[model samples]
Target: MNDHDKHIRVHIVDDDPADFLIIDELLLQSKRFQFEVNHISSISEARQELIDPQCDVFLLDYFLGPETARDLLIEARKVHCPAPIVVLTGVESGTLDDEVIQLGAADFLPKGDMTVSLLERTIRHAIQHKRAELELEQMVKRDPLTGLGNRLLFEEILEGSLARCKRAGTRLAVLFMDLDRFKEINDSLGHPTGDLLLLLIADRLRSVMRESDFVARIGGDEFTILIEDLHDAEDALNVARKIIQAVSQPSAIGGHELNVSASIGMALFPENGDAPIKLMQKADIALYEAKRKGLNSVQCFTSNLQTQLERHLNIEKGLRHALEHDHFELMLQPQWDLRDRRIAGFEALIRWRFGSELIAPSDFIPVAEKTGLIVPIGEWLLQTACRYLVKWRELGVSHYRISVNVSPLQLKTGHFVETLQSTLKSTAIAANLLEVEITEDSLLDGHEENPKVQQDLSRIRELGVKIAIDDFGTGYSSLRYLRQFPADVVKIDKSFVSGNGGEALAEPEICRAVVTMADSLGMDVVAEGIETISQLTRLRAMGCRMGQGYLVSEPLAFDEATQWALAGEAVSR
Candidate 1:
């Protein structure tokens, strides 16, 4: 390329004519890269020159008459100048370099050390560094996979829109959408297919929404849309329905036919919330309710949803505090052996003690799982349960194992096996005496074949620890999991075991099939939630060897369970 074609247009803003003449001479001597120089004597002249799109870099004098180079730098940035500004200063001070940079100067050069090579290098470095900074900033605001604005950019735009709406006395809407069964597609078809599906979804969203509206991919399978200048709240609903219809259509990706649906929750400006944070939170609450209802549904924010959201936030805070303060307690419920009628083992249930009251697991466990608190809380449970089991063994409780439930989040964390091994090592308990209970839902949707999950289970089993599937029949109940997952036991859900009166069993065929499958696989069967004698009798007939429920004995405190174990009760009254 010719020298002029490789030229960098340089703008010099200095009040001193002599300083500009010296810089112009140095630029001509460099000879490495062509310099097309423009010299302006005042900040006002530089501001006008900054508007030129061809300007590549700026050289500003640190002191320009009454004003400083900092003033001109601010003016350049105000005009959204893409060029970098290098400060040329006559004064030599220790902090002047930092001061110039803090004022947005890309580089600071002292006049005493001015040279042809130094000047050229400083100019080139400043421009290259500023370009990199801009690129990094753009990356931060965008989702790399979907090439869409991310949560950071979404929040920025939402704040601006909310402010505009407040002044115009108009309405805006924030819609939070979460895709349903997206994980299933990811697990079954692979992540490459899932990513392609998300790209297609982003395109569809852009096509359906008006050009004035904004859509952002906030997270995996989660997106947020902003609708401004809305005439009525119903306008947001109509937009939401359109997005649902567009997303629900089947798409072919990566040689797989994929189908997905979205649940959207919307919050209106000046009605649901006035601030960005509050509106986003309320919209999330609505989205959660929509998911609870079913896929492809929409829910508007309500006062009741806010109340629930507040309670959820409180529970999450309490859980964090409870973990740090040692405010959690474990209760052990006995698992009875139908054949031997003795305590086969106990399931360790975690309970949160909030002040004077005890909170049920059903109330807070879901919150923990949702907020990613479960990973830590679950590790605590495993370590504590192992310690308790060691204590029980020292107290002469033998031939009994303690089962701890594992959250799907915990398994997905990629360190469950390490945690289990570390707990066993620290507690010095026999690995075989600790049972890890996972729900069927955790293993469903191709998770059984997931290499990470399979490796985790295989390593755990290799450590001599037993693995059991908890609440087996309640989830997808894929029989493939029995053959694939390294499960030693299957716990039948309580729903099927309950309400079997006279000769009419609630789900006799399903129970028999599960037992038969377990027997064939050489896995032990445990029936959960046996409340009546008839239920227990029915389970024994179905060949379920172990059972746990209210009928076995309510989950007891450590001391009470110790007493029960010492008494060696064969059956509950």
Candidate 2:
């Protein structure tokens, strides 16, 4: 079918005058069909007329002088003509039609015994098909639910925007937004509620932005908003504030009133970044800062954010390097038996030496935890501590139990029991020597149901690994987890040990009550942060079996700790 077969305009490019006349008469005879026919006898004439934007489809005979219909089709393809060209042919036409279709023609119709209905059908079908294709192409570039550009579309749009900004010397902003505590809501409620909340959030975000701006949800609870044509930093700040207000509005789900908040980080063009990844990265750094400063706030990308992000990246890199190079060191703090007045065990604390600078456990420990470096770091600590136990035995020093603090995230991230078993095998450290301390928050979720935690702790205990509740009374303000778990010891938090007004008076009374409570439960009691002679005396009087603190000496270096261990001979002497 050629261009003239429809109600819309169709260009007819055929050199044969009689065949063109016959086809035109047939189209006219079909009174139900409407078409604007432009007849041309030469390829040059057809190309000129069909090139017009008004031209919809092309009808051409198999052959044109000097330029075969194939040549015209190839040229048409180059010109990006939207029109579909249909070739008219006979015997060779069938074979050539396939060739012509390969040249970008839409379809082919045999000239012999062809009906106007067939011609018209093919023409309408092609137009409808093209329209459908265009629609689908548009949909691919957009997010289905939010109607914002998807990641694929965002890249294309962002590239163009970057180019334009570079040429015009203009400023642009890219805002990275993450819904705070989204996982908590999903776990507490259900996935359906989470989805509903997300949709509501998307709607609210769209309502706040201008038509010139773009927003896209890239992952679960993560979104990127590009604010184009910004006048200044203050303008971008205003948009960020608007975004915070709009998303912070309360969203009701499953008949429950829920308030959701977002952390927004924004980076500007040229100043923050000139590329997509760099821009998004700076925005992400800003978002991290916002989250760190207590969620539900906005942070603009600055050199400070860049520097901090660089430092975190450096730390992450350094950790990986340290592990590869075996640079991490462990310090042991003695866990003393107050009744025996001897070092019964020690707690393994991790430290790092980066060049001449010593990084504290307090600084890099959380960094490791956040970046999932803890899994490896913790494993190393466990193995190294176990190795120390074997070394002490080799040196003929009295054997002592060693305690290690297990991070909650590390516990949940892998097979905790398997990791423990592996470390024991590697270092030949007895299961009884290794004690794992879990905090109260590990079990407390502001609710009573803690089956997973209970089961995990049970499995660890089954493997003969001793369990202790560290910083016991400071968390949850309740004794529910302690009651549920079969913990071997409950270490009183340093806060309680500090005592009121720096006097050991209130502490002894509290320790006496705690000791009494543990006695009732048939569990051992250990006091932490004992510094003064009166405090130690009070603890011993209260029947606390073990204690750890600065009184024994702050967590000491390995050499210092081993020297202190050798001092056991002094006590015997």
Candidate 3:
């Protein structure tokens, strides 16, 4: 049909017959548009007419027998009328126009200035403006990358769902999902491939979701699902499992075969939390626990998880305060040289003193790493160890080095080399007397290829500081990785040293291989966790030069470690 031939239904509500006649004549005079007008004389009639979605536009007079256009406009909005309402006023005051417009009227028209062309243009403009407003609202609620609902819409939906569940005495579930190893993939391949993978995973998620369930992409690699009207808690569990399986499926993107898995955490309504924020937080805690266990797993929120989350938050707060004040101390464990039969160096270990309780490194270091507090904390340890080395030199202790463990996050910081150089310049300690120990996994974290990482390592080595791979034979123990890494020492992990019980010496094949490899590469080897004499003797016989464990001495405070160094009794037996 032609645009002019299509009838535009216009509903007019006015008590005065002359006003109705004027509007009717105006519509009839229009040549470019066809209109079918429905005139109602009372508020009751207009309310009933607005219920049926027939009218394309609404024209209501400012006054209709004991009721105003504002009253009828509010009622129309309650019923969600799609047609736009334009107020017809006898007075041409700006205040009246603004009053009507604020009360849900699309626009206002004056009765004296009425013309066929003006009336037609007003109706078309009102309809188009309202449509654009609605479209903009929808666009704001969607994710730009995945075309799924974004975090803002997810929060809105959660608030509404929680209110409904509260009234109906029903249960709801909030599932927080995070893609595992997504950053590694993004860094290894590229962001474009990562974006494609996210889109594919989003499609997979939607394919398995029910019509009533809602899903949203709340972060770069995180999504949230809201399942309402649950009959039992098991229903939520079933949905979480289905999502895990669906997300685990392999997908090919950008000519690369990619496999991704999700860790899901679920929290139920009224049991886990009553508010939207609490529910989301609890689900996130459970999600982290699932990730800790491994990927491709589902974990449900429990009371213990809540307690742990609280404790973790407290620890994070306390750590920040501890770092600000001087609340951390360092202990040194001696590393004995089997060839020289004397103490070679000590590994600097950090300890936190929270009030009267002494928090072990095992308790607080992981929290520091996760919260990015490790960067500052590691710097503190580095400076403290170097200062100690300077003190030992002043005491006439010669031919000894101090080893300080470094976190992967610390090295990832772009200023690590600068920080080390500044520390050395401040302490004036010889660089050769300072050794930095990095875990095996840290070296495998794109260190060989990452120019920033390689540059940092190279600069540190240029300062004459020795680099040792700690916890060897535990993670990424590839011979090629070790050969490519610019390191001077390899510390065989305690697991291999103590694997053979205190019986007849059963040689550890891994230990022998690691020693042989380090020897060929001109790297010194330190055997860690050598508690028994048999373990020590076996390690010494295998050409492992340095050893550190309870057999030498437990991690000692500064004074005790200095006494052991001066006494020269590290291998008294």
TM-score (all chains, Cα) for each model: 0.75, 0.62, 0.68
lDDT of 2 by residue, 139-165 (tens): 887777667667766665676667657
Q: Which is the leading candidate under TM-score?
A: 1
lDDT of 1 by residue, 1-573 (tens): 465535889988888899889999989887788899988888867765654446788888888888888777776654446688999888988998898788788999999799999988898888889889878867899999888899987887787676557656899999999899887677566678888999999999999989889999988899999998899989999999999999999898877777789999999998987888999989988998999999899999987987898899999999999999988999999888776557778899998889887888998998998899999999989988887877788899866789999886787788888888888888888888989998887766337435687678888999999999988777754565468889999988877877554434467678888899999999999988777777777778988888987766889888887776776764333
Which candidate, 2 or 3, has the higher lDDT? Answer: 3
Better of 1 and 2 by TM-score: 1
Candidate 1 stretches with Cα past 4 Å from truth are 1-146, 150-171, 184-199, 250-260, 268-279, 411-416, 443-453, 499-505, 571-573
Residue-wise lDDT of candidate 3 within 399-473, one digit each (tens)? 678899988777777888889888888888888988989888667764743657756777788999999999887
lDDT: worst 10-residue window of model 2:
442-451
Error of 2 at 75 (Å): 24
> What TM-score, to 2 decimals, does candidate 2 have?
0.62
Count of backbone clashes, every candidate in sequence: 0, 2, 0
Report every candidate's CA lDDT.
Answer: 0.84, 0.77, 0.84
